[model samples]
Structure formats: C-alpha cells, structure tokens
Target: MARGLSQPKRIVILGGGYVGLYAALGLQRKLKGNEASVTVIDPQPHMTYQPFLPEAAAGAIEPRHVVVPLRKTLKRCHVLTARVTKISHADKCVEIEAPDGHTEQVGFDILVVALGSVARLMPIPGLAEQGIAFKTIGEAIFLRNHVMSKLDAAASTVDQELRRKLLTFTFVGGGFAGIEALAELEDMARFATRYYENIEPSDLRWVLVEAAGRILPEVRESLGVYTVLQLEKRGIEVYLSTLAKSFENGHVILSDGTEFDSDTIVWTAGVKANPVLATSDLPLDERGRLKATPTLQVEGLPDVWTAGDNAAVPDLSRIEEDPSALCAPNAQHAVRQANQMAKNIVSVLRDKQPRDYFHKNVGSVASLGLHKGVADVYNVKAKGFIAWGMHRGYHVARVPTFNRKFRVVADWLLSGLLRREVISMGQINNPRAEFDRVSRS
Candidate 1:
C-alpha cells in the first residue's frame, strides 16, 4: 500500500478540465517533498476556461489568454495530452489512447476521475454537418470568423436571397452558453456592420429558439424575462417554448412551422456527462456521472475521487432541505469541489480524516454584450451596466493563474481604447484548402 513517507505514491488524474487542472494544482501545493508522483492526462495541452468562451467568440478577449497551459502551469506534474479510454479502479489501471492512435495501460496508486461533460447534442437531421458547438476555444474562434466572413460575402454579393440567408443567424439553446454567445456575437456582428457599405444592423436577423419557456434558468425567472426584453429591444427574435425541428442544408424548420434559411447554426442546448464514465468499473448515477460522496471520494472506493460536472456529489447546503439535492454540474461548484478534494487526498496520505466539501453557491452573473448584463448573486439582483461589470469582475478574478488574468484584463482595456475588431480570418479555418488547390494546379 502506498501511504505515509515510505515511498512516493503514483497519482493519476484524468480529464484536465476545471476540476482536473485545479485539483492537480491543489495537490501539487499540498503534497510534501516526494510525497506523491503526479500525472495529469488530457486530450488538450491546455485547459480552456469555458466561462470566457463568449468573450473570446466576440473578440472581447484574446482566445489564447483564456486557456491555461498545463505543462507550464503544473511544473512538478507529468502532463500528457491523451484520452483515457477506460478506468478500472479495482485493478488501479486506466487505458489511455494517445493522439497517434496507440493505446497504453497506466497504473496508479491513487486515481482521480475528473472527466467532464460534453455538449448534449440531439438527433436532429443536418445538425451533424451544419451545427457548430460553442464549448471550446477552437469552436469559439471558428464562430467569430464564420460570422464575419458571412458579412464579407454578403457585402460583395448582389444575390439578395443569399445575402439574407448569410445574414440570418439562428441559435438553438437558451442556457447561459446560448444566451451569452448569441448576445455577444450578435453585438459583435452588429458592430461589424459599421464598416460595411450595404449591410446594416437592421439587415441582420438574429433568432433564439429555446424549447423551455425561458432562458438563463441558472439565474431567475424574472431575470430570464428581462433578458428576453433586452434582446427584443435590440431587434432579436426570442422564441420561447419552441424547438428546431430540422436544419437540413441550413433551411431551418421550427416546431412552430417557422421556416427560414440560415448560413450559421450554433447548438448550445445542454451537455451530458462524458461518455467515458460508462466504460469504467466505477459506480455511476443514472446520468452516467461518477457517484461521489460529500468528501469527494468515489462511492465504495476510498483511493478513488471524483468531482466536477462528471461527478454527482450531494449538495450539502441543500440536502437537508431536499434529500435529492446534488451539486449542479457547473464551474463554480467544480472549482470549489476540486480544492476540497485535493485536501482530502492529502489527508488520506497523512493518515488523517478528510472533510466534506461544501459551499453555498454565491450566485450567477452573465454578460449580455458590451456594458450590458444581468446578475443575481447572493440575492443581490442587478441588470444593465451594473450586472455587466459584476460579470467581468467575477470571471477575471476566477480565471486561473495571474499571467492569464493580466492578459485578459489587458484585452478588455485595449478594446476600450480602440474600435471593435471587424477583420475575419476565415481562411485560417481552411488553411489547407488553398495549399491543396495550389498543389493540384
């Protein structure tokens, strides 16, 4: 058994997301000299702070600044850019698939199941080919370029029908992601029109469709209503209790029989726990999340721990009032849970009792656009400029390392002094296409 000061324990952390990255950082700080050998495995070399994805999409923040490089940040830990195919806690071994198509079995004394969630895509026709997800930095950058490129094409083309289709943007989802992304990009696209000779803000059609009756359910019902009003005030069409029935060839068909052609389609409805959990021997809830205790340890397994969006931890603050209360799969809870989980892992190493992770959610704040937002933190409700400031302040304070925070702050500061960036590098998305054609010629 790996314990105490006898020898270094081999520790492996899966999924370098908010939980995996932060928990590893915590463990690195908490562990004594040579107490444990830490290894972090993830498909990406960096952990993208998803909260700033909207800002990145809208060019309010540099895309590179929002992601924390794992190798540079975790100097003492082994960071591997690979995917975990399987987890077998009974044998304490995980199957890792490398990027080059090779698989290897990695053994560890301590295992952390931090694999996060993925975009919950529906089985809508044409979605696979046309729908874009807004979860990662790549997708965010693609959206910024795609939207602007459409505007460029529209400006040069005299085809009225094609121009209308290019200008029509449809977003299917009303959660924080869908709302913030739609708001910020719409704001950016509107700002971009200033440079175009023919295109105007009024010429662009922005549509938001949510099957639910309201958007931003993470906030409050009242705030959701206010958001609709704000979007409508900006000439955006907010369709609540509506669903996108189909999107074959960008010809959108809604449940309400609203049909229109759009060149851009963004899907941000919801997410399911990472499907990797199903392949593991660990106990999982109905939603395929790892079953974890309040102390952040995997159910029925002491050496294994789980947290974040992938773990169904009991909501300590609400469990007494509601026994069914489980922590929501969000960044706020994930970061806090990871911090506590790190301490728990260290306690076990030193033969001490671990404490349960608990923190009442402070609140949620969302940016609508430049100088516009809505927030409800600690029941202190706010809207417009006040809420926008709160949203920026909260995220800037929470975005990982000091270096990244400085850069992000500088991005906002510089944008204030200059006009919004309207240039589109759409060619970057198809950098190989031009080269391939040149080679053939």
Candidate 2:
C-alpha cells in the first residue's frame, strides 16, 4: 500500500488524543521486533485527559499533570507535532504541515483516523468573538486566569455597574463540561472571596443556560434534578429550557427574555465530529463521522481503522434493544474503543481475524466541585460525597499511565490540605504586552 516498503507496514495515526495515545501504547507493547513501524501525528505534543480540565481550571490539579507527553510515552512510535492537511487513500499518503508552515507527504500502509471532535458552535451574534470554549488545557488555563482576573477587577472597581458585569458569569450548556466547569470555578471563586476585601460569594452571579428541558442527560433524571437543587442552594441560577439568543458586546440575551451583561461567557453546548473527514477519501455517516463496523474497521475501506469521536462505532451493547445505536462520544467509550482497535490492528498484522468491540453503557458520573458529585453506575444511583468519591476513583483508575494517576491524586491531596490557591496570574496571558509597549515608548 505504501509503494512496496511496507513489509514492516507503516501505521500512521492522526490526532494523538485518547485513541491515538492508547493505540500507540498498545502497539508498542504488542508488536515485537518491528511487527509494524508505527507513527503518531497530532498538533499537540501531549494527550490531555479532558475530564480533569475542570479541576485544572479550579486549581484542584496541576495543569501539566492532566496531559501525557506524546514523545515520552510513545517511545516505540514516531511522533509528529503537525497539522494533518490531507489524506489520500488513492495515493496512500497523508499531507501534513508543521508549525514552521512547511508541508510534506508521508506514505502509510495503514491509517488510523482518531482526529477527535471539535466544539459544536452556532452562528450566534458575538458568540465567536465573545464566547470561550472549554475543550483544551490551554482554554482551561485561560478561563481560570480570566475568571480570577474578573474577580480582581470586581474587587478594585468602585463603579457598581462594571463590578456587576465583572462578577456575572454565564455558561451556555448543561452537559458534563458546562456543569463541571461552572461548578468548580464557582466553588473556587467563592472560596477566593475570603481574601477579597469587597467581594462576597453571594455577590457572584453564576448563570447556567440550557435549551433542553433537563441537564445531565447522560445520568439519571433524578440526579439531574438533585444537581439543579444543589446549585440553587449554592446561589447559582439554573435556567432550564432556555437558549443564549445573543452575546453582543457581552450583553447576554436569552430566549427566556433574560438580559444581562457578563464579562465571562463560556460555551460548552456540544461537540461534532472532526471536519477533517470531509477532506479525506473515507466513507462517512450522515453525521460526518466515519462509518465503522463493531470491529472498529472503516466500512468498505481496507487498510483504514477508526475510533474515538471521529468513528461512528455501532453500540453492540445496545443493538439487542435498539437496531441503530452507536457509541456516544465520551472518554468512557473512547478509551475502551482505542484498546480494542489497537488489538484488532495487531491481530490483522499477524494475519488473524479481528473481533468486534462490545462494552455496555456502564452509566455516568459527574463532579460538582470538591467533595460533591452525582453518579449512576450499573443502574445504582449515588449522590453527594459518595458519588464524588466514585467520580475520583473511576477517573484515577482510567487516566493513562500510573505516574499521571499518582500526580493527580497527590495534587488532590495537596489541594485538600492547603488553603485554596486564589491569586490571579492574568499577566501570564499576555506577558509580551508590557514589553511591546515599553519598546514602543
């Protein structure tokens, strides 16, 4: 497939997220003495464990601990920090551009499409310029620094109108990302008020806007109700069945006719499959995800495999009950899918039949800041502190590499023992601004 030098077949993986990282790690272990030459390519040098991003934003975990360095971990594979420009199955090659803006084509005998989903954004007025998305570690750090900066601004300002705007934080989504981000940040900000001379926890107005009738659709409906109650008890406003109509100049207008000015507007509504699929010669489903069978092989396409958010893997666990059920785009599914996909890849390399992936929806767990959470595992429901422990235990076990797990646990322990870290490092966002101004002067 790669023009005759594929005896040790060239395996190229796109997007070093959950699937890429895990698949490479699996291959490194399974393929002995050059069973196949492996390569992994992604824009970022590390694979971020996204579930911990909220805690990273809240200062509960160190930002670096949540990401695994690709080069260090994927030792047996070639790691490339480059953007994939194109994939040509007919040519059996992929075009990539490095940070230096140079492009080149790399031939591959097998291709792994794991370019995960992107934020599902809509054309709302001012949303693009004003809305902050919660996807990457960079965004989490930015949000944290920005939120703290707002607190600093609110404390120093004498003008009530500006203070009100600075203190109001509006989150437009009620899924796991939105709820966790809002909850952790709100909790941290509230704790920070202890040091502020003027600001109070009650003075902060945290608003959650969801168009759906209910939030946390991944969990039990009763748990969703409980989460709303807990947030309400903490003085957070929950606007269910509402939409963010506009965010013109930070003037948030909701479908429910609620209008307010907020300095912070976060969008975590949903995610769509990566748009890169449209550029490739791969079979895609109606939703723009790769059409994959239960075995994680690209439908009707030889030498191509897919998993994670980019692959529309049939939910074999649900097929008995529902004919058209596909795996949801979550870490729970992504991680397991990668493990299975890797083994299947190795099996095919050794000239063996591949097996289908099957894992039941084990249920979901969500953290509502420190020591508070909700969980529904195996039809059993949990709430409050116990659920929070479950949330911590589950993720600590699942996060790749024991080193990262230890660090995350240690960070949690250290955070619990010490006072909440409350200082704002807003200057970090633009360290060169002052330098530029001084040079101009």
Give the CA lDDT, 0 to 100, for residue 131 in model 2: 95
Cand. 1 Cα-lDDT:
0.93
> What's the lDDT for all of these models?
0.93, 0.93
Q: Write the per-residue lDDT of candidate 2 for residues 1-441, one digit (tens) a residue.
A: 224554688899999999999999998999976578899999999999999999999999999999999998888899999999898998889999999999999988899999999999998999999999999999999999999999999999899999999999999999999999999999999999988989988899999999999999999899999999999999999999998889999999999899999999999999998887899988999989999998999999768999999999999988989989999989999999999989999999888988999999899999999899999999999999999999999999999898999999999999999955877888889999999999999
* C-alpha positional error of residue 309 in candidate 1 after TM-score superposition, expressed in Å: 0.6
Q: Candidate 2, residue 219: CA error in Å? A: 0.4
lDDT of 1 by residue, 262-328 (tens): 9999999999999999988899999999889989998899999999989999999997899989998
Write down the TM-score of every candidate: 0.98, 0.98
TM-score of 2: 0.98
True-vs-predicted CA distance for residue 284, candidate 2, Å:
0.9
Q: Could you tally the backbone clashes for each prediction?
A: 0, 0
